[model samples]
Target: MAVTRQSVEQFDLDLSELHNDSTTVRFYGDYEEFEEPVQRRGKQTAAMRQGHSKDHRPDLKQLLYILTVSEDGGVPVYFTTDDGDKHDDQTHIPTWDLLKELTGRTDFLYIADCKLASSENLAHLHRQKGRFITILPKNRSEPRKMRQLLTDDPDCVSWKTLYEIRDEDGNLEHRFRTPREEEMTKDGYRLIWIHSLVKETTDEASRMKAIGKTTSELSRFRARLRSPRTLMRQRHRVQEEVEAILAKRPVGSFLSVEVIQEEEVTLKQATPGRRSKKTQYTKETKLRFDLSWKIDADALEVAKRSDGIFPLITNDSKLSAEDVLRAYKRQPIIEKRFSQLKTDSCVAPVYLKEVSRIESLLCVYFLALVIQTLIEREIRRAMDSSGIESVPLYPEGRACRRPTTRRLIDALSSLSHHRLQTDDGDTLSLYTQPTSLQSQLIKLMGLRPSSYGRKKN
Candidate 1:
């Protein structure tokens, strides 16, 4: 908290808009002590328990790292650790309250994921006269209603092109649109739905891939059922297997499975010798099961109709759909900070078992993120002020428009100073000469090249 306050005052950061998000840090080993919160320094440490692992390692225990950053330069302003089992929706109210206390205002637009759209969280923020923008979860009725509306009448919704993004070659990369008619959530909050051409194509392709995978797996399972050693002869077992296959993919709604049963009969001579009329025969019967599936054309068409659409809910009605989208788009800034925390800083694979020490280490990670973002912000600001578009920060003298802190560190990593003592007791000092690109990077960061290896007094 002190570091965040100092950063805001030192850098004159913008407090009008803040983005908040959380990520899980996975830890290995059996942390018996952390099965529950442990008290230290008169405060309980966050428990490292199993929960929804964003790292996709549910087998390993983890703790959630919640961070909020300023939109000015993606500088982290607030962070906290929570129990791994804690749900994202349950953390927003307390986080919002802390932001209010930290910023000394309630008007800052807090942006987050669908977890922030919960009724309890939104109502609390709204009641406190706070403004926020968040994605509406697909489970919500508003999205279902809009999808059904679109499915019924494809042209019912009037769309206005909000913006378009183009590549350097002037080719269209993405296009965004919103309905002309204003929509409101059931709770009376402004609900704006956005359509993206790129996202639509991506969603359609992903759905088809999943459906193809599901179909292939079902075909394999059908082939397995024919094997003589296969134990899946019962109809219920076959149905269960089908359910398990469908559960692994989101294409379950678009496919239907049926278990077909048939009876098999055999006749054998009782005396173990085949004789036509004199020998008695024994008959035995057994049941066999098979699986068949088909893709539901109607359901697939309905889902396709809603492919590119997503809803954004906001309590601030004065903000237009474009403004909401522009603000929400910056939500990835917090995600980028999280990426740096995990990947650049390597905050995961925590070797420490003590929750208090882990918390302290997370604090250090937060401080590191702050320093990194400050350096990045300063260099970018310098580049803009000097009218420079890009620098050779990439390998083989490739130009990099927006340089990251990791790249800066890599560029300066090879620099070193060596000292030698002669037999006559004379000391010599040698410093690695900075390359042109390195010198330019130093200048862009507002540092003097001559002071690169100097000792501080």
Candidate 2:
């Protein structure tokens, strides 16, 4: 809290907009003590139980690392550790309340993912006069209604370009459009639907890929059914296997499966010897199951209509659609902070078993993140002030417009200082000279070149 307040005062951070997001930090130990929250210094420690593992390692125990960063410079201002089994939607109200206490304001736009779009979370924030922007989860009926509206009358949505990006030659790379008339969610919060052309292409390609893979698997299954030595004979078992295949991928909505049953008759010699015309044989009937599938044209059409569509719900009616879109677009800034926490800071793979110690280590990691982001923000601010478009931070002297704190530290990692003591009791220190790029980086970070290798007090 002290560090965040100091940073906010020193940097004059724009607190009007804050982006919040969470990532899971997996632990490799039993963490039996943390199966339930442990009381430490009169506060409950986060339980490292299993939940939705963002790291895709559900077998390992984890703790949810929730971080909220200011829009200015993506500086992390508030963070907390949550029980691993707790759903994100349940954390928003408390997180928002903490932010309100921290910033002493309720009007800041608290942006997060679809988890923040829950009716309880949104209603709580709305009633408190708090503003927010978040993606509407696809499970919601609003998206389906919108898709149906679009399918029935394609001209109903009057789209205006909300955001776009273009290459140097002015060729459009990506474009986002929003309806001129903003819709409202069923809960009466403002709904801004965005359509992305790039996302549309991506969604279509992904659907085709999933469909192709699914069909390929089904075709192989069919071939197996045709084989004389195959064991897949039960209709229910074949249907279950087909359903599992479809469930493995998201193509179930676009494909239909039918289990075809066939009757086969075979003659077996009554005796164990080789078959012969004189030998009496018994005829047996067996049922065989085969699978056949085709794309559901109606479902495919409906999915296509909603390919690039996504909705954003917010309580602030005064903000323009473009502004709302822009705020939500910055949501990825918090994701970058998460990347730093996991990769650059190496906050995971914790060896500590004590929950309190783990929590303390996380606090240190949070402090490190703050300092790292501040350094990055300062360097970028300097670059902008000096009109320096790009720095030679990448290997092979490639220009990098936005330098990361990790890359900056890596650039200076090779610098070394040596000290020697002579027999006569005279001591001398030698320091490695900084490269021109290193010197420029040091200067940009507001440090004097002469003081590059000086020891800190």
Candidate 3:
């Protein structure tokens, strides 16, 4: 079952101890797969009104996923689904509401990617007394104007920042809002064009590669020459290939040939005594093979400046520019979480056939992720203490990382060993003491055996 409000409200009680006015919360979403199943348009497929299954590809719809995270890039899965309406934020309103409740705070940055960065989602965030930083969609017609208003114009340079704290009951809580800085951080966004950089980088790299290839060919031509005729043929071939370079297809598609059958083919003068005929087949076929080559150009170069780098849109006021950039980079953490949830967790191969059961399994995996995160955090803590401070027990966000919860729980279960006593009064070892991980978990959970003993009878 999807986690209910009660479950989130319970977590909020524990969360209250950790967060304060200086903290920032975030949320993000990513599309795991671009295409969804599309039903075959055949008359029979349509007439039956049957849906698609995992074994088949049907009318693929978009999966609008939602993830909420702490300031530290720890992701808490919120929602994942293919909304038939193709709506973005509205598709997960309940989940978002549950998140606010889970966080136990109304004023926090609910970071998300471009898709969830819709006007509706922003408005929803505002309506809930929350804030978010999201990369605006370049497709928005007025975004260029927004960018100019924020980054280009003289007035846009007049940016200001302020921090504030508010009293809630007896506790002092931080409430950061850039009602003015919204033009820059939360709402003000500029579309950065990297296409020029990409093109220039590509051109320079191509030129250098061409020069290297020509030099290499010349060296090979000079070295391969055994007789005067071989030298002439190699020289001529090099020049022809060099001239055709510009018009030639990419290296992967470059033409290569060997004459198979040609009656006019000239055999070596020495071979004339042994062979009456040497045939060369002239048949040719165009084939595109996958080839690997490196360009001396910087590997960081992109075909389009905007191809990989994303637009920086924000409304965060208190955070410095460096922090803002770092915050934006945390978007990918959600993606890794989604991937882990679906793959290692095997959430998709949900045994329950019912859709609700599938959703329930999604929730179970999400909780498992939470447990995994806590386990990793504790493991990292131990590793840090043991002087392996720079290392992680398990790679975080590793695509190939297995279900950490299973491994961690198994480790924990194995830690508290128990051995039965013999009947002959020979003492046998009983349960072993809790390991550092178990103790860390106990401390983490604030568990108390004494308190349990005092419970109502």
Candidate 4:
């Protein structure tokens, strides 16, 4: 489907990250769930049950907004909450535990936004400390620790590290580290921050565009934190404040607190070498060289590029700033999964009610998504022109963004109605090929004849 391939490339499914080359993954999910209006005829009291407000067959119902996540991107994954209101006295699931359980494999790194930016999550991460990159919230006490790191003081310098790792082809991976500085802002929020990284986030072209500040994507990243919703909430509150201000002018004063952060990192380079960040383009266009050599042997360091930014907190000794940012950026993939389920899968615009039914459908939605993901990747890799003869069972471009549930169910499985003539003169539809879609669905179930009678001659 157009939807499936459009946004998923950002997920970073390269085989190198997988332990078994088929190992399961645990990443991140960002989504929102809203209430559906009840549709029913006028007041037999039936209309009231659907959440309709009017006696005239209620058309609308109460709305509950949900923001949730999933682990392993599969059916068995449980509904997870980052943070939300609790109607009853119920304990909510935490991100750390859910990840540990969903991924039987421990090699995966879990990524999340600021909601998981609590001391609890960080402490537990240090304990089990599986691998993670979480954005530190400004409210955290970390600012004190990094206080000396963010300054123009003469003593401030960059920290750097270099490692020798092999590529999938056994080739050497030239990796180096550097401190990253950024100023982040949105509608009503701003953060000054610094992070660490190695290598480029994308190819040379992308690197240049970001550097030139010509990329909308990068611009948005710098601007998205202060969402429109935050403004809306504040505006709504202000309306009430204005009413009070008008009723009793200056009787009481309201002060707005602006949380401003100044972040700087004093990178103490662990390595001794001249810094030459790999130059992107080659003079010949074919033969590329590390164009810029470390002009100064001093440790590679960068200062805050903008005024305010939020730093990504990490305890990973193995990954560099580049690695951390790249992993964090890849989080959009998990979000794409939700988009697929809602649009291509058509699961969100549902007709069901009752929290239990909604939950069950969520289960079905995830299962279908997993099948679609696997099928999609398999099809692309098992190219039709290979020594293998059969075409991909997944079939290329199956859905636009994601496959519809009905379409995906059909792709992963198929059903047939059969009737047999009996002495009782009865006929019934017989279903076949239950669980018929494994790696064998196409091999065993394709192109079968449907004739039951022999020639009368």
lDDT (tens digit, per residue) of candidate 3 on 396-447? 6233122244445554465443456799877655554565545544443446
Residues 1-457 of candidate 1 have per-residue lDDT tens digits of 7778888898888989999999999898989779799899999999989999999999989999999999999999999999999999999999999999998999999999999988899999999999999999988898888889998988889999999999999999999999999888999999899999988999999999999999999999998987777888687788888999999998888999888898878887778765877889889877877778889988988788888998998999899899999999998988889888888998978888688999999999999999999999999999999999998888898999999999999999888888899999999988887877788888988788766665546
Q: Spell out the clash pairs found in candidate 2.
A: none
Model 3 clash tally? 25
Sort all candidates by lDDT, best to worst.
1, 2, 3, 4
Report the alpha-carbon TM-score of model 1 versus the true structure: 0.93
TM-score against native, each model: 0.93, 0.94, 0.46, 0.40
- The C-alpha local distance difference test score for the whole of candidate 2 amounts to 0.89
- The sequence of per-residue lDDT tens digits that candidate 2 reaches over residues 197-300 is 98899998999999999999999999999999989878888888898899989988788888989999998878888766789988999998887788988877
Of the two candidates 1 and 2, the one with more favorable TM-score, higher being better, is 2
Candidates' lDDT values, in order? 0.90, 0.89, 0.43, 0.39
After TM-score superposition, the amount by which residue 182's alpha carbon in candidate 1 deviates from its true location, in angstroms, is 0.7
After aligning candidate 1 to the native by TM-score, how far in Å is the CA of 8 from where it should be?
1.6
Off by over 4 Å in 3: 1-65, 73-85, 92-95, 127-129, 142-309, 382-387, 390-457
Under the 3 Å rule for N, CA and C atoms, how many clashes does model 2 have?
0
Candidate 4 regions exceeding 4 Å error are 1-95, 102-107, 141-177, 180-310, 383-457
The local distance difference test score of model 3 is 0.43
CA RMSD of all predictions: 2.6, 2.4, 13.4, 22.1
Flag the better candidate by TM-score, 2 or 3.
2
Listed per model in order, the count of residue pairs whose N, CA or C atoms clash below 3 Å is 0, 0, 25, 26
